[model samples]
Every structure is written in structure tokens, then in C-alpha cells.
Target: MFGNTLYVEKIQHALEQSNFPATPDNLYDPVRYMLSLSGKRIRPLLVLLGADLFNIENIDDALPASLAIEYFHNFSLVHDDIMDNAPLRRGKEAVHKKWNESVAILSGDALLVKAYEQLAFVKVEYIPELLRIFSQLAIEVCEGQQYDMDFESIDSITGDQYIEMIRLKTSVLLGGALEMGAIIANATLVDRKHINNFGVNLGIAFQLQDDILDVYGDPSTFGKQIAGDIIANKKTILYILLKSKLEQEDTQEFEDLLTNKAITSDEKITRMKNLYQKYHVVQEAGELKGKYTHLAYESLQKVNVTEPQKKELYSLADNLMRRTQ
Candidate 1:
């Protein structure tokens, strides 16, 4: 089986070769620009890896579906940046910032349409099931985004609600991508469900890792602005866990810090990090990430594939959890 490097290169080359119309520059340019940004491409990689797990001979058959997942992912990001009013994406100007919001919205809509267009090229036999999976994934992602926005307004949320939000907003696409590949490879229904479960659990772990990294990772390698979550007052696991552990006085103080407009962004980040350290939220977040990662491995173990066939996926999951970027 090909390793992750080869698969990533294949996906990159396919993206480079993707055809887009020239005349409608405003509508299509942001789509192209968004795709051009550097990303881990984890979701598309899941599709390819899922196919390989079943000993699919020509992994190229999975490319259209992979690209579909990618396009849809970028579409979400473009709109998400707008909603978050985030100025940067991948450390560059956001689509809404580089172009106008109108162009970004139209381009994002076009990317969703392009995702469906890529889905059309899947093997005829698999198209119907792929469509069904893709549609459900799309709706779930929207619902997850809505939940994320909703959380911003609510003062607090349970850890379970936070996990469910990330699972929907982020994890389901990973699960759906793997399921699509399994369908294309004609894997049995049981294997498909197991692999999807693996991806979902793994994706949750991945996002939790991200939540930690957002606060503590090296800005040069972490891709986006450091301490972004703290700056946005996002209700991350760290935030929730810290809040739960704080004394009554400290809880009120923490609320004051989050709403304090007088402090510099740097000051806010520093204070938040200090509070996180004091409360041991980072350590607790690491523990939670470990829990999900263990769950992912358990699911992966249930897949009906040979030990050798599972090596690459196991390696990929390890690398994902261990990644600094």
C-alpha cells in the first residue's frame, strides 16, 4: 500500500489540475484561491486511506470523491471566515478580506456546487450512496457551525455539548469521507461502519488537539494566529474545564477577563494562558484528547482488515495526534 506522503502528493496534483472556468473570475477566483491555500488535507486523505484499507487496486477511483470532500471543506472555511469575521486564513488574508464579502459568499456557494460536480464523476454504481452520504454530511456540518455560533452567545456549555458540537462541525466529514471510500471499494457494511466510527473518534481527538495547540503551539508552525480561541472567547474544552474548576471569586474574575476591553490582545492571551496553567486545563484537555484517541484505536481495531493492511492508517492516526501543525 502507498504511504500517506504519496497519497498527499497525488491529491495535491489532482487539485493543481482541477479545471475552473475563467470568465466568471469573481465567482470562481475565490474558490481557486481558497483551494490554493496550504492545508493538511486530512479529510481527503481519509477517503484515500479508507479505500486502501480494503485493498482497492486503483486508488485513483477514489480521487473524485476526495476532491469533493476537499471542495466542500474549503467552501465551509470561506463562509466560516466571514461569519467569524476572521481576517486571516492559513496565515493569509481571508477570502472575505482579500475580495469583498459578496464575492466571497458567491465563491463559497460556487465551491459547494463544484463539490457536487466532482461527486458526479464517482463510479456510476456508487453515485447514489455517495450522494446520500455527502448530503447528510453537508447538513450536519451546517448544523455544527450553527451550534458553534450559538455557543458564543451562551455563557457556558457542558463538555458533552462541546464534544457533540465539534463532532458535527468537524468530525462527521471525516467519517463520511471514509464511508464514501469504503462504498467505492465495495467493502462490507460492517467494515464501513467500523471505519467511519474510527474516523469520527479520530476527528474529535484531532480537534481537541487543535484546541490545545491554539493556545500553546508555536505560531510559526501552527498555521493560524496563536491564542486565537482565547482572543475570540471561544468555548473550547479548555475554557469549559477551567470554568468548572474555578472558585466562585475566580469564576467571576474569569468572566471579567474575557469581557475586559481595556487590555491589549497580548495581555489577554497572557492572562488566559496563566489562568489555564493555574487551573490545569491544558493537562485536562490532553487527557480528554487521549481518551478520544484511545476510542479511535478501539474502533480501528474492529475493522476487518489484515494487520499489515492497517499499518498505514495506524501510522497516519498517530501522526495526526502527534502533529505540531
Candidate 2:
């Protein structure tokens, strides 16, 4: 089985070797630039890990599908950055901030096309199923983004609703990546489904941790601006839990604080963190994350692979759930 380091190096090399046309520099350069940025590459790693569980020798067969997932992810980020009007991605200027919005849009569209082009490299026998999974995941991610936007305008959302939104917006792609790898390796339907479930559960836990860390993590280690979600008044799990525990008067006060644009971000973050601490919302969010993470491990245990073969994935999931960045 390939270690995480080997898989990371392999995916990095493949991405570096990816062929893009030289003409239409405006359209392609942003795609190239976005790909060039440093990211955790967790989705592709999940694909490779999923294949390795089946003891597949020619792991290279999974590369195209893995790259397809990666390209699609970057495509979403480019467009999302434009929509969020975010100034930075991965601690550097976002594609839209670095270039004009029109160029970012065109490049992002080109990336979606490129993702399909990468998928073409998969063996013909597996192409149909892989495409089906990829297409379905793509649509679900869009729906998730839409739900996120809709929640921004709505007055309230339940915790269950928030979980569903994250599952669609974030978890399905992780699940699909694992299933695609299983398809490439000719794994049984049962094993494939189990692996997909594992990825989905883990993805949710990861996102929940992200919500917790937004307010609690050290800015120096987080690599991006701290309290960005708080600054924007984005409804994270912490906010949802805190609101659920507060009285109507307190919840109204929280809303007033969120809407008071005159207050500095530091002030808002301080006030919100105080409320979160007062209500033990951070501790509650941690418990929720632990629940999903435990579920993920249970799903992993259902895979048919031997215990020894599962070590790498266990290590990866453990690290992911504990990450601060």
C-alpha cells in the first residue's frame, strides 16, 4: 500500500504533468494558477486510498478520476470565490481578486470542461459509472451551494437542516470520489457503498471542525483570516447551536450584533465568542463532530479489507478530524 507521502507526491506529479493548451492564455492561465496553489488535496487522496484498500497494484488507473475530482473542486472554488467576494484563498489573493471577474468566470468554466476531459482517460469499461457518479456529485455540490446562499437570507435554520446542507454541499463529493476509486478497482458493490459512506461521514466531521476552528483556532496556524465566518455572519454550526440555546431576547441581540456593520470585526468576534463560551456551544460542536467521526470509523470497519490495509486511511481520517487549518 502507498503511504500518504507517496500518494501526495504521485498526485502532485500528475497535476504538474497535466496538459493545457497555450493559446487563450486569459482563459487557461487562471485555471493553471488556481491549480498551482497549495491545497490539502484530500479528495484525490481519498480516491487513491479507496483503491488501495482493494489491494490494487496499478494505482495509476485511478489517477484520471482523481484528477477529475480535483479539477472539479478547483472549478467550484474559483466560482465560489467570486460569489463570496472573498479576497483570499489559501492565504493568497483569490483568482477573482488577482484577475478580473470575467476572466475568473471563463477560467472556472474551462476547468469544469477540463475535469470531464480528465475523466476521459479512465478505461472505457469504467467510464459510464464514473461519469454518472461525477455528474451526480457535481449537481449536489451546486444544490448545496444554493442552500447555503438561501440560508444566508432566511431568518432561521435547524441543526438538522444545516447538516443536510453540508452533506450535500461538501460530503457527496468525498463520497463520490471514494466510489469512483472503488469502481476503478472493480470492488464489490457492498464494499464500494461502505467506503463511500465512510468518506461522507468523515467529510461532515471535517466541516464541523472547520466551523469550530473559525472562531477558536490561532490565526498564525490557520493560514487564512480568522473569524471570517463570524465577520460575514455566516451561519456556522457554532452559530446554530448557540442560537438554539439562547432566549428570544438574547438571540435577537446576537442578530443585532451581526447586523451592526459599524462594529469592528474584532468586536463582533469577541462578543460572539463570549456568547459561545457562555453557552458551551464550542463544547457542543465538538461532541457533534465526534459523533460523525465515530460514524465514519464504523463505516470504515465495514469495508472488506484486512485491518493492516486500513491503517493508512485510519491515520488520514484521524489527522483530518484534528486539523486546525
Candidate 3:
């Protein structure tokens, strides 16, 4: 079984070896800078793992597809950061923050084009399916973003709607990456579908875990601002659950906490967290995460591989679910 560590190293090396054009510094420099930030390469790792599961003869053959996913992922991040007006990424200046917004926009577009170019390197037979998955995911990502923006102006959103939003915005890419790898390995249709489901479910749980961490994770290790979601009223799962459970009388307090500009950010977080505990939303969110995590494991089990062969993926899912930061 190929371990994640080995695959991570391989992905890292391949990304390092990739060459970008030198001239037109404004355009290419941000692309280089964004890649250099190097967040967890989880999406590409899924691509390699999906291919490996089917006993693909040459892992190297999948490198282009794997890189394509990474490029697309970074491209999404660059634009998301700009849209979010996020100042930091991986503890460094975000692309739009480092350069100007216009440059960040152009560079992000370049990354998206580069992703298609990488896809062009795949075998001709695999290209059609890969493009289908990639394009569908790309469109869904945009839809998810639009929905997310729509939610900002709306007062309330249901739990199912939040789940669907995260599924499109974040989970599908992970699933698509796995499917692309399965295509490269020439996996059976059933196996491909099962593995894709596995990645998608795991992604849902992963994002819910992030929701839990945002309020509760230690600020020092959380990477981003702890309780940032709460402060922003970002409609996280926890927030949604809290809204669903909160007493009608307390809804005013909730609104006050979010709208009261006079309170310190820490005070707002503490009060909201206290309310979260009072309504048991935090525990409820954890249980929901566990439910999806279990579903992910079940999906992985349907992949037609032996139990021993699934151990590494099992371990990967376990570590991701339990991660504190």
C-alpha cells in the first residue's frame, strides 16, 4: 500500500519541478507566489490514492491530472481569498494583499487556464471524462459561491441548505479529484463511483470539523483567527444549528451579539460560544460530523478493495477527522 507520506512527497516534488513563464512578471509572479504558499495538498493526494487503489501500473502517468487538481485548487483559493477580502493565507500575505486585486484576478485566471493545460497532458482517452468532471465541478463551485454570497443578505438558512452549500463549494472538488484518478487507472464504473462518494463524504465531514474548530480550536494552532466565523456571522453549521435550537426570546440576543459593534470580538465569541453550549449546538455539530464520517467510511468500503488495502485511506480519514488545527 502506498502511504500518504510517500504520495505527498511525490506531489510536492512534481509541483516544484513545474515551470512557469518568466516574463510578464505581473501575471506569472502571483501564480508562482500562490503555489509557493503550499497549503495541505489533500486534493491531489486523493487523486494519486484513487489511482493507486486500482493497482495502476505507472503512478507517474497520473501526475498531470494530479497537478491539474492542485492548480485548480489554488486558483479557487486565490479568487476566494480576494472575494472574502482575506488578508492572510497560510500565515502569509494573500495574493490580492501581496499584489493588487487586478493582478490577483488575472493570475487566478491564468491558474485556471494552466489547469486545463495540465489536463491536456492526460491520455486522449481519459480527457473526455476528466474534462466532464472538471467542468461540472468548476461550474458547481461558482454556483456554491453565489449561494454563499446570497446567504449573507438573507436572514436565515436551514441546515440542509448549509450542507448542500458546503457539498458544492468544497466537497465536490475532492470527489472530482478522486474520480479523475480512477479514470486514469481505468477503474470500473462501480469502483469509481464508490471512491468518489467516499471522497465527497469525507470532505463534508472535514468541513464540519472546520466549523467546530473555528469556535473551539486554540487560536495559536488554528491557523486562522479563532472564532472568526462566529464574529462574522458566517452561517457555519454551528451557527445554523444554534439558530435552529435557540429559544425565540434569545434570538434577539443573538442578533445583538452579531450586530453590536460596541462589544470586543473576544466578548462576542465568548457570549456566542456560551449560547452555543446552552443550545448544545456544538455537540450536535460534532455528532453530525461523525455521521458523515461514518458515511465516508461506508462508501470507501464499497470500493471493491480488500480491507487490508483500504488501511491507508482509513488512516487518512481518521487523522483528518481528529485533527485539532
Candidate 4:
């Protein structure tokens, strides 16, 4: 987190050293401005930490690829906001809302290109492997976004499909991120594979936790309304799974609650959520999330890294799984 001095300092140092200009007058100004907004920087830090975990002395050798991952992530968010018609991001106006969808989309595309530009800086010895993994992740993220869009239009979607969608959209990048770190350090194939597995499994748990928080987290901590997902009728795991739990009459009642042509904002929030609670859906979601978290730890333990190094990763994984956001 930015609260940590090393994490904050290294990222700041990386941004400062970047060839990207400082003046707000340039077309790329927004890129710098967006980066300056000071995110958690967890993804890049994961890269640094994972590399260091292998006792690699030259952390800088891997930093460019690490930053490329972060840039690609923000790029996805920019386009995603437009697709979702979301008004805010990180407690501020979304890029699409602040400017226009056209500008937001173009800016997002620029970020995507810049991610590869940064990747060019990664050491040549590792670039080929990095590109192979990174390209797969990039394509899968787009596929995941498409799947999410498909869910909105389709009436029937399996829980398996939902998991696959999020795995691609959200989890694969984290896996590639750690994998990139291992590649830069030239870690053993087994260690690299294990670390990547850790990242992917943790990512699944992270998104599931996000779904739970959307329906139940404290607003003060969440920075958004609890139950916002329910109001939108988003096909979260809780919603899809509980549809099977309800009896015929209860299913009809639930459908009626969501089928309103124009649902009253308050009623939408209340009815969908209370019904979720009635079905104990959040509890079931937690069970699924915990399973993934345990699997992440299991994979992490297989890595041949030192205990002290693994300890930090374990701590980070615990925080991520427990975080309300």
C-alpha cells in the first residue's frame, strides 16, 4: 500500500524517472495525471516483491515490465467505465464521465499501447517469455469483459461461466504479474509456476470478496453503496447461485422484484438485498471465496522460496482476501 514507505518511494521513483512529460498541455497529460492520483500500486509492488523474494539483487531489471502491468490494468478500467457507464472511479469522476466516452476510449487505447512501450524496456533475455504471458492475459481480459457484457443480455448463465469470466478478466493479470517477476529473476520453472498459481487463485478470491462487499460492506469503508450490485441486477455469484435455492413461488417473487420497468431506487436496493440475505447467499459466497484463498496458500507453499519471503506474500494475500474493497 502507499502507506508503506518502500512501496510508495519505489513507485514514485519509477514514475519520476519515466520519459512521460509533466506539462498538462500534452495529449498524454491525462496519463500522468491519472498515474499521479496515487493508487494502491499493489500490482507493481507484487512484481517487485515477487522478484525480491527470489533473492534477485537487480530489482530495476524487472520494474518496467511490472509498471507495464499497472498501466494495462488502468487502461482496462478506463474502457470498462465507459462500457458500464460508471460515473466515478476511485472516489472521483470517471474518465468517461469527466471528459467524454470518446476521449476515455481513446485514452484507454493509448494506455494499452503505452503498456507495450514500457514492456520494451524489460531486459531482452526475459522479453519473449514476458510477451507470451502478457499477450495471453491481455486477450483474456478483453474476453472476460465481453463475457460480463454477454451476461447482461442473456437470461441464463452458469456459475462456472461466471468464474471463468472473472478468472480471465481479473485473475490472469495477477498471475502474469507474479510470473513476470519470476521470469526477471530467472527463478526455477517450478517456483515460477507455483507463484503464478498463487496469484491466480488469490485473484479469484479477491473478486468474490468484491462481490460480497458490493452487497454488504460498510459504505464508509467501501466508498460506494452496499447492494449497488443488487440494484443493477448484476449477475454476481450470490444472485446466480441463489436462483436455484428458491422455490417456484419465491423465484417468481424475486423475478418480480427485479423485473420492474423502472424500479424505485430505494426498493431495488432493499428488496434484492433482503432476498439475498433470506437465502443466505453471502454466506455461500464466502465459502467459495475461502476455498480459493486456501488453494492460493497451498500453491504458495510449494514455491522453493525462503520462509521470510513467503511470509510477506502470505500477509499480503491475507489482507487482499480480507479487504472490503
For candidate 2, give the lDDT: 0.89
lDDT per residue as tens, model 4, 20-60: 65543334665665666668888877787778778777877
Worst 10 residues of 4 by lDDT: 21-30
Error of 3 at 251 (Å): 1.7
TM-score winner, 2 or 4 = 2
Model 2 TM-score, 2 decimals? 0.94
> lDDT per residue, candidate 3, 230-250, as tens digits?
888789999898888889989
| Pairs that clash in candidate 1 | none
State which candidate has the highest TM-score: 3
- Tell me the spans in candidate 3 whose CA falls farther than 4 Å from its real position: none
Question: Cα deviation in Å at residue 125, candidate 3?
Answer: 1.5
TM-scores, all candidates, are: 0.93, 0.94, 0.96, 0.92
C-alpha lDDT of all candidate models, in order: 0.91, 0.89, 0.89, 0.82
Worst 10 residues of 2 by lDDT: 247-256
Please write out the lDDT profile of model 2 over residues 1-325, one tens digit for every residue. Answer: 6798999898999999987888788888888899999998988887898888888779999999999999999999999999989898888899999998999999999999989988889989999988888999999999999999898888778888999999999999999998898999999999998999999999999999999888888888865579898887789999888888887668766987788888888888899888889899999989989999999999999999899999998998988887754
Runs in model 2 with CA error above 4 Å? Answer: 261-264
